[model samples]
Target: MNKVKLAEGVYYVGAVDWNLRDFHGYNTPGGVTYNAYLIVDEKVCLIDNVKAPFAGELIERISEIIDPAKIDYVVTNHVEPDHSGSLPVIMAKAPNAKVVLTEQGKSGIMKHYQTNYDFMIVKEGDVLALGRNKLHFLPLPMVHWPDSMATYLDGEQILFSNDAFGQHVCSSMRFDDEVDIDQVIYEAAKYYANILMPFGKLITKALGKTGQLPVRMIAPSHGVVWRKYIPQILAKYEEWSSGLTKDKVIIVYDTMWGSTDQMARRILDGVAAAGVTAKLYKMSVSTRSEIIAEILEAKAILIGSSTINNGMLPTVGGLLLYLKGLRPMNKLGAGFGAYGWGGGAQQNMEELLKAAGVAVQPGLAIKWVPDAAELDRCFQFGLEFGKSVLAANK
Candidate 1:
């Protein structure tokens, strides 16, 4: 993509990854974008860079606006390879430019790249003057990464947030208003659920620190820029960071011999009967990342796994492990499973849920394939769980 001007002097010089399907384990079928910004002023500045393979594309976009050699400052918001993999190449082109990043960012860059470069370490509330424009730095440690930080362009009222308000979406449209609002919000929630869920407290702290800034535009390091819907995205981040959830239930299960699957369907039916929105996902068929996204806003999560060798199915175990790492908060959950002889899957899942900070309730463990009576019991379990979810929401 070519450089598109965001403001009078700020331009988006980034690359879109339309073919990317997976990001670290998160299923990103919609692809993603590596957003970098070029600020043209008395002292030209470049905020963030694209992935290593897209470095050439990033430079090509910048060349359309100004000679890369003219850039005086290159700001590294986060040292994650997706945003900083092309740092060496850009710095090589802009030889005279100084590298400005957080002190932690400095250590990370050196450890990752093992290269020496002119560095200007910055901290929270530090300001850098770019002639008429000023860049205010906000240190956001553990907001996904220890080295992560955001840059606020005082003149344009733009927050160059790296990964904080981003989505893993690749679109020809650059701004939030130009694309489908539902798709944007879904992708944003998915990103937050997968990458930022573990850092809820840190995110809350970051939001509080930058809450007073006059942010009219949010130029994240990925996906579309937020100009018209800044408040909408901010509100979402606030809600998510606070561990707020809706009256929704998610049922994730992995079945063997179709026994557990039968239980899952009946439970889902009961949840619906209780006037609650419930989504069912089979772990072997559905993407865990997508399930995690659903769990983000869901008040209840029900996991089912058929026992195998005195343990839960591999797919269910893997999903629970991934979910545990993401650390979803403020959720009520339970487990259910079918076993031929030994029953341990329900207890295992409940333990995992508790480890993930989810409030665990008594789970059901059925012997072998469930009969009509057992299915009825499953339905009752779902009804009780759904009602409890509704009560918690109220």
Candidate 2:
């Protein structure tokens, strides 16, 4: 890729990952961009690096702007492998460059690579003058990782946000406006839901610092840069951080003999009948990350599964375990399922729901296939749950 200029003295030196389908535990079907930026000033600065495999690509891009040996400062904004995996390669090329990062970042990098390169440890509010522009560092501890930070360029008024406002998508376009706006926004929301939802308060705190800056462009470490819809994305982060949600419900389930499926569908009908929006997903066929994204803005969720070996299905357990760690905010949840003999799925689910920080109530458990009367009762159960959600939201 040729150097895509962000400003007169800055250019995009990142590599797009087109074959990646999963990032950590989350699904990233459209792939993602490991964005790195290079600034040509009195002291040449490289913002971040791509995945280890993309190190050569990054060098090729940097060579387009200036010889890799001309780099003076290599800014490691995040210590995650995707952003810092190429640090060793870059440092090898730029023999005079100092790796500038937070203390925690330095420790992590030292442990990860065991390299004793020249390290410049920076902290929040620290500034480095690059001749025409001054780079300001803002340490954001545990926004996702303790080693994460953002770089702000004073003269250009750009925030090189490492992970905040990032989307897991690889597109030919570099700027937000150049891509499909709706799709970019959707991917951004998914990224927030999956990666940063648990760190909402930390993000809100970080935003307080960033909100005070005079930012003209938000060049994040992933996906396209945000310039045209900065206000829109900031508004979304605000709403999400504040735990805002619409009157939407999600019914996710996995059925062995189709009995639990019947209950979930009836519940969806009740949710619709109660004048609320609802989404239904079968865990056996659905991606857990995608369903979690849907749950991000939902007021409530009704999870179901068929009993096997006196416990909920493995898929349901996996989802519950994932939610427990993510700890989605401000959600009312419950369980419903059908079992053949001794039932345990509903109880198992409710316990995990409580552990996940959801305000869970008693779950509805049915034995064997539902008859007409049982199905009616299931509908009533869903209707009552839906009504309860509406009332709570009000």
TM-scores of all predicted structures: 0.98, 0.99
Instruction: Show where candidate 1 strays beyond 4 Å.
Output: none
Model 2 stretches astray by more than 4 angstroms = none
RMSD of 2: 0.8
RMSD each, Å: 1.0, 0.8
After TM-score superposition, what is the CA distance of residue 26 in candidate 1 from its true location, in Å?
A: 0.8
Candidate 2 residue pairs in backbone clash: none
The per-residue C-alpha lDDT of model 2 at residue 164 equals 95
Write one digit per residue (lDDT tens) for candidate 2, span 120-168.
Answer: 9999889999999999999999988999999999999999999999999
Residue-pair clashes per candidate, as listed?
0, 0
Q: In model 1, state the lDDT of residue 320.
A: 90
TM-score, candidate 2, is 0.99
